[model samples]
Target: MKPRLAETPVLLGWAEAPLSPWSRFGDDEWLLDIRTAGRRADQNRISWAVELPEGAVISRTAWRGLHQAAKQFLWSMTTNPPTGRQRLSPSSVHNKSSALKTMIRWMALDGLETFSSIDAGAVERLRAWLLVRPGYKAKSITANTVVNYMIVLKDLYRQRAKLDDAPLADPLPHETTYEAAGLTPATRGSIPFIPDAIAISLLNTALQWVEEHGQTIVRAETIRREAWALGLTRGARRQCSYHARKALRRANLIGPAGEALLGAYAVRHAANHLVEACYIVIAGFVGMRVSEILSMETGAVDYHPIGETGVAQAYLVARLFKTVDQHGGRVERWIAPEPVVKAVELLEQLSASLREASGRRELFLVKNTQYGEIVPVTQMHIGWRVNDFARHVGVPMHEGKPWAFSSHQFRKTFARFIARRDRSQLFGLAEHFKHASVAMTARGYVGSDFDLRQLIDHESRAETATALDRILLSDRLAGRMGERIVVGNARFRGRAGEQVRRDYIEFVLTETDLRIHACDYGWCVFQAETSRCGGEEGPSEAGRSPSVCLSCANLVIEPRHAPYWRDRRDRNSDLLSRANTMTAAVLTEAIEQCDTVLNRVGEHDEQV
Candidate 1:
């Protein structure tokens, strides 16, 4: 008789073709013969294939490495593009070239060797050798770069072992650096930052100087140099002041109002210095990041809602590219202070003259030139320029000063001042800054003893206890647990339960997570002779030597089970409403049944 075809088994309630049994090998090698019909050979053709090749395996690793290398190259290009006396944006070309360079380097190091030929020693030696090379130590290579190389190496080895199921054992060693620990005492708070008071004074002086000089033309370079030294610092001229003004103008802080604010200085010093002063005030007062400030459009700030009478405030809300990266993927919020508002008003006034000269309405702010022309400038351009100007200024340069006044100093200063005012408002400040965590704000940007103090207090046990008392005195908790049954459990019995209750009460009163008392039985009280008597048998001990707590605990208090069954209680009213609504349609039918039963009862009484 002819052999019968095998029946397929059901999988997940559906029939499927039977899978061929796999053969196991002793040496850990998997060899399989896979076949399928092909159209290339004939009308009913079959394709036969053998083992997967090493090249195919290695190619996957190479491709992964190439992808990472390409991204790193793009990042590097964006960060430090090769601009050889060019006026064009070569970002795309530069990224391509950079990717090629990285790929070549990776191929030379990792791809030349076969998977079986490489070992842990090879990887170690490669890193050691790279470290010794010229310029390798100049700047620590980014972790991303090393990761790319390893990805390629891993792919190569994974294929070489001719194994598809197992993972490759390759450990890439990373070089330890100050940034890795997330905190390095030497640099933890050592950022070059400027103090608010000094910044305020600088803004005031610059405004005074600009006001004294009326509409006279002055060189942009001269104005920038003076503003950098007098308003910010010698070191912040190019790095902080230059960018600060540029950002101020971009943020609508240095236009017509800004110019009018420094009205008298229109002629003596360049009008641009007024613009620079406007930037300083906004940067010093608003506490916005340079990038956010730079990326701002004209309408990003609104003053109409306050009816123009509320304490001078500009609502600063904008999306910034740089701050987002630093803040661990979060947007930033800046609440412009009084001085910042005044500064923005001053800038709005100046922008009139700027627009008249440029004959443009869309381009709100621009770099002021000696020729009275406005030149376009981005945050990065102004940042480097300000740094250069700061060096020329006589402002003292000190390492680790919170306000060396980088473009970031404005944000830092704002955070510091608010922390000092009301420490409990940290969450608000964190929300304003668009930071993922207060820790991030504290670590990378914030610099002030007051901020640390406020942070410590916010997280303090004593402070939490006091706050909890205020919350408990209110009726919030009573409303939350209206009719729900609550259960408590613990692995330990008797004495353990009592100790836990005491400890829990202490902790709840002193901690942050909201909780109410769940039980009153003390482990000591239950353990000390209570169990010896029948009372100790506990409600839960129905089947065992020691009953579950439910079996004996007389402490069970069901509020609803109380005789005071006032369904009208404020807490129970909500439940009553829900029940009433659901039974409303069935009410007529229930009433009719009751009337029929009453009539039948009356008829039976008459017969008796």
Candidate 2:
């Protein structure tokens, strides 16, 4: 066998060649070297690459070789990635570094020392080990997580193949086959939306609390301490004239201090409630992600003129972590409602103390009394506060457990509210959510609630009832003097008018073929299976004209529709009066059509 070199070659000059002028390490590049004792610069300080064996096996020479190769691969990807590929973000690089370390540790455990020994069987065995391996908190590893490990391995081997370094023919299995071995497919989980009732209650309580307390809460400690001091002094007073007078003063001070302390305590309690309330209102109403909400600056909210109109439109601008371009930055703009604007103002006031102390303008900082320092609010902090608020306000049980709200739920709820009000607004909602496509918005944001079906049925019934009322009580029909009027098998008499109306409504509701639709002149009782109207074929057909419904057999008129036909007749009369010989004929025909509709409803001779 050829003797292995004592040291591995350094592929990239990490210290000499700075990735950029603004790199964290300065011009003293000689301070960093690959073979430095104690802690190597690449392994410890500036780089994510770890020292590994050089050869394909577990010998000392192989460890050194692998470590140097891995470091070069990582450095290349970070600064000068292959064409058509961008440099990895810091987070991505960190993830890859961690995954590679885990894979090396797994290889050491399996007694596999060399790169050549890592065949498809070794990779498969590593996959099985990862599947049953205990992860954080001793939970079994997830399928998605296993997939990530496989991807890192595949990338490592592909890089080795490019350099003709490793002896393996196929280092990793096909990605599809590797991923399919996992328990579940890799996909984003469904987003949870808070129940509408719970959302409303939360907002209402929050808004009410904010209104009751102007801005910041005054701590009770100052006033309460004063009151306690006075109480102690009053107790220490002796029973004498001099002491009695002093006791009187102490007692007087105690009463006022006690009242002030109580008031302060109330304000303090209100302040605690307002913190969560403000967050909920802003998150739920504004539809901003938790990260964006936390990233807001002191002056993020602003108002500007909308187009040429002098009317000012309020909006908020915040940093967006997701959906960035090639550059690692994205900004999102949100149109703010009045409630969101007020909530933001309240947050600014609440965070003022923290902002002043830390010299940081982040809108959601909280002062840590223990450390006497202000820190940026985190997801865990928000979660704890939300749960605290929910407990305080007695948030009702959800599925036999107390409702545990999260910040993401607020965003999903906001999307659902927009979709419920007007489905067409979903496209606009997608823009607000910063989603790439409407389909993504629909799948993730739009969800049906338990009461959705009931609500739909209720609205349908209300519309049908309105249509039935309009057709039953036409003034035109009432004007016709007859004991009974007959149409087909149905009969309507003066005494039995109410009964006939009831029967018609029930029939319309029960029969699927019968439909009540509003036409240009009045309502049309179109029966799909029995109607002879030519308009059913197309709108341009002869019976599809506005005047066709006036003379059609399926026409229905009532008092509710009288005003509309009257307006048309009067307009036509005015047009006929001003018409020339050519226009007079058309005007006259329109006038006749209006007259026929009025006469059918018994309103032909009632008025102009």
TM-scores vs. true structure, each candidate: 0.37, 0.54
Clash counts for all predictions? 66, 24
lDDT of 2 by residue, 1-608 (tens): 66333222333243344534344221312122221111112332344334543432355565544444445455556665656777765445555656656776676567665555677888788888888889867998776677777766655555553332443555545546345445443443354667755777776666654544433232222233344455557775332333333433443322111332134344345555677877776776566667667778788788878689687767787766544542324665666656567777777776666687789887777666787677777766787798898878776777788877877777766655543332232324344445443333433322222232333244345445666654454334421111122232234335567788778777767775444544334445554433445544112222354555444555555544556677887998988888899899988888776676566656634422
Give the winner by lDDT: 2
Q: Where is model 1 more than 4 Å wrong at Cα?
A: 1-170, 173-192, 195-269, 304-313, 320-333, 349-376, 388-393, 399-405, 421-608
Candidate 1 per-residue lDDT, tens place, 459-511, comes to 34333343333222221111112111121233212554556544554676566
lDDT of 1 at 560: 19
Cα lDDT listed for each candidate: 0.38, 0.55
Q: What is the lDDT of residue 279 in candidate 2?
A: 79
Model 2: weakest 10-residue lDDT segment is 30-39
